[model samples]
Target: MSADRPELDRCSRCGECRAVCPVFRETRRETDVARGRLLRYRLARDAGRFSAADREAFSRCLLCGRCLEACKAQVDVPALMQIAKTDSGFAAGWPSLLTEKTLADDGRLDAAVRRYRSLSRWLGRATPDDSGLRLRFALPYLDAGRLYPKPPARGYLEQHTGRRASGVQKLAFFAGCGAGRLLTGVGEAVDRVLAELNLTAAIPEQACCGLAAWGIGATDAARRTAIAWVRSFAGEEYDAILSPCASCTAHLQTRLPQILAGTEFAADAARLAAKVEDFFAWLSRQDLCFDLAGLKVGAHVPCHARREVRDGAAFVSFLKKSGAELVKIDERLDAQCCGMGGSFGVLHPELSRRIGLPKVAALRAAGAAVLVTNCTGCLWQLRDLAARFDPALPVRHPVELLDR
Candidate 1:
C-alpha cells in the first residue's frame, strides 16, 4: 500500500460498496463515493494530479465507514480518509471551529457549560406566556426547537469520582466531547449503569478521542489531542476504560493503540484497548437487569461500531434481556450511513440530510416508540431528524434506556 494513499491503494475498486453508500445513492456521482475518492486520492498521490478544489472534495466525506462494511475487499475507509486528510491539509470545517472554540481550552468549555446551565434554569422558570419564552415564539432561529426530555443536568463524569466504588472491577469514563458537552443525559446514564455493576469509574479530564480531528485531516491536531489525553491519564490505572460514545469507543479501541504504538504511552493505549468495553458488551456479560417494562425500542448501530467492534448487536441482546421489545430496524443491520458522520452533518447539511432520510425511514418503519443508538453523533442527528419528521418519535442513547 502507498504510504500517502494506503486506503486508495487498498480499495479494490470492486464497486461492491456503491449499493450501500448513501452519498453515492444520493448524488450518483462517482467521486462522491469512497471508491472514486480513493482512486482520485491515489492518482493525486502518485501523479501529483489533484486540483485544490478536488482536495476539498476529499474532506467533504463523513468518514462513516459504511463503505468499509460493504467492502468484501476489507478496505479501511476511515483510516484511508484519515491519510487523505493528513496528506490534503483540510480542516474539519465547522467542527474545526467548534473544536477550536470548545476543545482548544477545557476552561472555556467549563465556562460555556456554566452559562448554558444558567440559561436552562432561567428558561425553566418562565411559562410559555412569559416575556422571555414568548420572545422566541415568532422567530425561526430562536425557536430552533426544543429536545425531548430536555437534556440532562450534568455530564456523567461530573457526577462521579475515581473513588466512588470499592469493588471487584473499576472503569475510567471517557466521555467524548459530544457526550460531555452535547449529550449529557447519555453520559449520566452510563454512570448509573456503572454503579449498578459496583465498578467505580475515574472520570478523567481527557481530550477528545481524536476521531473528529483525524477525520478532517487534522493529523497534527489529532495526535496532539490524543497525546494530551494520554498524558492526562498517565498515572491512572483502572480495570478498564469505557465509553457510551460508540465512535469514540471504536477509535479508542482500534486507532489509538496504533497511533501510540512504540511511544511512551503505547502500553497505556494497549491497556486501554484491552479494558475498553462498549456499554452494551459489558451489560451483556453482567447479571444486571433493567426495569424496561412495556418499553418498545429500536436500535441503529453506528457504522464505526459495526465496522470496528462488530459487537453492537450485543445491544439487541441486552435490550431483549431487559424485557424491552427490540424492534429490528434493518434485517442485516448494515443499512447505509446515518448521514451525521461525526462532523459531516455540520459540513454538508443538505447532503447529510439527504443521506439521513433513509435511516429515518428505517426507524419509522420499525414502528417502535423510541429509537436507541450508542453513538453521540448518531443520537444528535437522529434526534434532530425525529423532531423534523415527527416530534413524537423519540431518539435516545441506549444507556438512557438502561438507566430508565
Candidate 2:
C-alpha cells in the first residue's frame, strides 16, 4: 500500500542508506542519494512545490531497494518517488510520459521498433551481434563502441504456437518484455530446459511488466500495463506462471497485487501474483541434477530480485546440487545493485555505467570466466560489461546451463 498510502513520513533522514545505495555510491551527489531525495520530496510535498528538477532527482534513482533494506526507518523510497511521475502531476515531463505511452500502447511499440532500429543506425550506433550485444553509446563514460542489440526476427511467444503444452505440471511462461522482444533466446533456453525435464510451459502473449513505468515513477501507466497483463491471461489456468527474468518475477509477486488494489482487476492481480515463483527456486525444488564438470561460475544477484525473491539460499542450494564450483561476489550477498536499474540507465547513463561496471570488473578480477544470474536485465548488463571490460568472459542465465 506504499504506492497509495506513501510512507515518506517514516524517513528520519538517518543517512544509513548512504552506505548501501548503488546510485549514491556512484554519484556521491546529495540529489542522487536516497536520504537526500526523500528529504527533497518531503520538503516539496509539504510546500506544494514541484519542479522539473524534482522529477530529474526522482528518475535518477535506480529503485534497487538497497536503501530500504539498509534504512532503519524502512522508508518506501521508490513509492514516494512514484508520486512525481504519476500523470496526475501537472505535466511532470513529456518524454517520460511519452516513453510510458509507447510501452502501454502495443501497436505504437511494434511500429516503433523498426523506427528505433533505423534511428540507431542513422545515429551510427547500430549493432547486429547475436551474442548478447551491450549497446555502449558514444558517451564519454562508456567505452567507445557501438553495441545496440537487435530484436529477434520473431519473438518467443510468436514461435510457440501451442497453448496446451505436454506436461503434468502446466506452467504459463510470462516472458517479460525484454525476453519476449529483445532477448528472445532466453525464452528458447527456458523452453529447452522445460522439455529436458519432460515439461512444457505455454508462452502466452504478455505486456511489458510495468516495472519500467514504476522505475520512472509513471504509476498510472504501470497500473494500466499490469491490468492489461492480468486481463490477457484471465481465463487461463496453470500450475504456476514463470518468467526467467528476475525483475518480472519480483514485481508480479511482490508489488503488483498492491498496484491493482481497489480496481476490478485486484482479485485477478492477486490471483496471478500468488501463482508466480522464482524460476531458480522452482528448479532447485525439482531436484534436478546439474553436471558442473569442474566449472566455476561467478554470480551476480540483481537488486530487485534480491529484495523480492530472496533466492540466494535457493540458488546456492541448486549450485551445490549441480556440483559446480561457485565464485560468488561477496558484494552481491550484501545485496548490491547491478546499476542497470532499467530507466535509471537512461536518466543517468554515466552513473549507471559507473555503478554496474565495477561489479562486472570485480567478477572478472576474481577470476570468473562465466557469470550467471536469474535476471535478464542483469544478464544484458553483465554481458555488456564483459564485452567492454573482459572480452573473453561470458554471462548466462542460470536456466541456460541447467538443461541436459
Candidate 3:
C-alpha cells in the first residue's frame, strides 16, 4: 500500500497548534504537539534509534482530529499517527477487560444496560431524563443524580420498520458502542426522531467502530474490526447508515472506506460510506418540529465533527429553528476539547483535566443551564468535569432537546 507521505509531511513545523492543542496546552512540551511527534518519528527513522516510548507517545493521541483542523495544510494527523501505532507493538494489547469481554459477548452489553435501568427504576431514581449507561455499578461515582429516560421498550426504527423490515428508505442504525451501553436513551431518541421521518432503522449486532482501537495505535485491529463490521452489514438492502454518535458517523464516513479500499469489502464499504449520515444532519433535513423556547443552550462542536462536516453550524441552525436560544462559547486560547478526546482521558487523566478546565469554565459562564452537543465523549468528559466543578449544568444531546 502506498503511504500519503506528502500530506503527512505537510506539517510546517509551526508550533501554532501547540498553543491551541488541548493535549499540548496541558503538557507544554514540544513532543506533545503534533509537529513535534511527527518530527521525532522522522528523526528516529533517519537515526534508527526510535524507541518504544516514541511509539507509545504517538499512541497516546486522542485522534480527535484537532491538529488537522488547526493545520493550515490540513495534514491528516490521526491517519499518520495510526500508521505509526501500527508499526509499534500497540496492536498487541487486548482491549480493556471491559472492552474485551463486551466485544466477545454482545449480550453482556445489553444485559448490563437492562440491569442498570431496572435497578435505577427500583431505586425510584430512573427518569426519562437520564443519560449514560444506566449501570448500577457506575451509579456511585458516575450517576450524580442524573436521571435518564427509560428506553422505549423498542427502538424507534424497530417500531416503524417492522421486525422483518423492508422499506423504501431503509436505514442501518449504527448504535455506537457507547450508544447501547452508556447512552441508550440517546440512541432511542434517535430512533424516535427517525421514525417521525418514516425511515426504517435496523440495528445489526456489530463490534466496536474501531475508533478507540485506532486512537491507541491498534491499527490492524481497528482495520480488521472495521472490515468485519462493514462486511457484516454490506449486502443488506439499506439506503443509509444512520449514527447518533459523531465519532461513529465520522469513522463510517471516512476510516472504513479508506481501510477497505481495494479489498472485497471496498465496494460495500464505499457504498455504506456514501450512505452514512450524522444524526444531527438527518434531523435538520427532516420535517420534525419542537418547542424549545424556554430553554437556553450552548453547543460544543466536536473537533472531528467539524473536520467531517464543518463547524456544525447547520445543526445549531436546526436547534434554533426548534426554538432554542443557542449560544456559542468562544475560545480565545483554544477550541473546546472538553478533554474527553476519547481515550486521552484514560491515558492521561491529569493532563486531560488541565486542558479541559478552560472549556468547562466557559460552559459555566455561558449563563446557559444546559450545554448541548453531539459527541458522546464530549458529554462524558464535560459531565465528569461538571460534577467536579459545577454539576448544576446539564450536558445533553441536541436531538434529546428536540420535540418528537
TM-score top scorer: 2
lDDT of each structure? 0.68, 0.69, 0.65
Model 3 Cα RMSD, Å? Answer: 4.9
Candidate 1 residues lying further than 4 Å off, grouped into runs, are 1-7, 10-12, 47-50, 92-105, 111-165, 330-334
Cα misplacement distance, residue 184 of candidate 3 (Å): 2.1
| lDDT, candidate 3, at 178 | 61
| Estimated TM-score for each candidate | 0.84, 0.88, 0.81
Q: Model 2 over residues 274-374: C-alpha lDDT tens digits? A: 88877777776784676876767777877766677646336655765788677656654336777777766655656767787877777777777678877
Across 299-323, the per-residue lDDT of candidate 3 in tens digits comes to: 7777667777432446678888878
Candidate 3: the clashing residue pairs are 127-149, 128-149, 129-147, 129-148, 129-149, 130-147, 130-148, 130-149, 132-182, 133-182
User: Which residue runs does candidate 2 get wrong by more than 4 Å?
Assistant: 1-6, 87-108, 117-146, 310-313, 332-334
How far residue 134's Cα lies from its native spot in candidate 1, in Å, is 16
Top lDDT model: 2
Which should have the higher lDDT, number 1 or number 3?
Answer: 1
lDDT string for model 1 (1-404, tens) is 13544445677778988877777788898988888888777778777555776666675677777776679878877677667666665563434433453443455656666665666654443322101121223221122242212334664445543334356976677777777765557666776777777765777666577777666667666666667767656566777677787888887788878877878878877776777778787778778878786887867878777778637557877888778887666654335667877656755666777777666767677767888888887877777667667667877877777765
Off by over 4 Å in 3: 1-9, 47-49, 93-168, 198-200, 310-313
Clashes of each: 1, 1, 10
What value does the lDDT take at residue 69 in candidate 1? 65
| Model 1: number of backbone collisions | 1
